[model samples]
Target: MATAKTRQKILQTFLDLLSEHPYEDVSLPMIAAAAKVKLSDMRSAFASKLQLVAAFTEKIDTAVLDGVDEDMGDQPPRDRLFDVLMTRIDVLAAHKEAVRALHVAARHDPALALDFNRLEVRSQKWMLIAAGIDVSGVKATIVAQGLAVAFARVVGVWLEEDDEGMPRTMARLDKELDKGGSFMKRLNGLERAAKGVRSLLKRISDRPARRRPRADEDDGEPDLSDKAPAGA
Candidate 1:
């Protein structure tokens, strides 16, 4: 549709400007002019620069999600993750310079860096799910955050890797994922232990309450045996 095209153009124009200039230096008006849309049109498409950046990220997420290979269901988790992440990088290849420029800006801007991390964490959740990884609870959030940080490192290598096959980037990703898999194993152990404790507590709390022993029916001892543990 026309609206979608305009939004895409605005985002592309912003990226093009970022490739040529610092992210801090690119303004909404400049993007509007470069995109050939009126100020109002640009506003209608995106409220601010950060939102535009988030939209661009969502675009990449969609591309990567859509491109997931169904046949990879039988692949090892790490291999599937590698395929998903590499697909992400390939989608991002067209705007490599823009990404590099944004990274430079983030390095100097704490706010931008934090914002970028938040977006990356969100996107990495989908990437994990695409790789058939469980993203269900607090542990899944930690995993996504860790993956986001690791993928950022891979992208750092990728930005400078010029070899046709990107050997360096691929190697870095493999190392990162290998490390991450070990971390996940440890984390899963802890999660299982925690779950066991919670289940035990739940079982203790759900036990039936015993009736108070009547004076006439007293068996010589107070019947406190069926009480749930304190704080259960």
Candidate 2:
């Protein structure tokens, strides 16, 4: 329990620092100092800043998953997804500055952007499952990737929209989800088409091969006469 608290403290301290500073400006030593832990102890909890960020992301994912509304089970998939994503934004409201900082850093750093994308896609998969949406097969990954991008845009709007009701943020989210739903329909159609093509090719490949008659061979024709040839 002490170890867990220490880890949480480290993460919290990092977020606080991130909120006040750019991602590039925050360092491991700074987090250790801010958290009042030994540098070695901080290292034991997290090896690097990226890992710390990833751990923070996991913490958020857990919070969102745990808070999933059971009553949303009967809701349409899009509505369920909207609720889940809005819940995420609500949870992230406290750390808005930190998210904004990371967003800015990621725009300039290709490596950071790529790393964050992986984390976003993974978290989006869980969100999809929470919404009772299918996350199976390769198309599921495409769906997740699309959601991640849409969610990022929503977050961008969220950071800029100061209105308490977040009218703009909600509006943007609704629009993105509508676009995503259309894309999903197209993806499903393509997947079905691909499956049909694969089935046809398999059937063709499984067929028995027909052999051609050889030049010197008689083509299974029966002899009319029962007697042997005169030479015989």
Q: Per-model C-alpha lDDT, please?
A: 0.92, 0.92
Model 2 TM-score (2 dp): 0.92
Per-model RMSD to reference = 7.8, 3.7
Residue-level lDDT of model 2, residues 1-232, one tens digit each, is: 2399999999999999988999999999998998999988987999998898898789889999999999999999999999999999998998999999999998999998999999999989989998999769787789999999999999999999999999999999999999998998899899899999999999999999899999678888886556777766
> What is the C-alpha lDDT profile of model 1 across 18-120, one tens digit per residue?
9999999999999999988999998889989999889989999999999999999999989999999999999999999999998898889998999999999
Give candidate 2's total backbone clashes: 0
In model 1, which runs have C-alpha deviations exceeding 4 angstroms? 208-232
Collision count for each candidate, in order:
0, 0
Deviation from native of the Cα of residue 9 in model 1, angstroms: 1.2
lDDT value, candidate 1, whole model: 0.92
lDDT of 1 at 209: 83
State in Å the error of residue 192, model 1.
0.6
Residue pairs in candidate 2 whose N, alpha carbon or C atoms collide under 3 angstroms: none
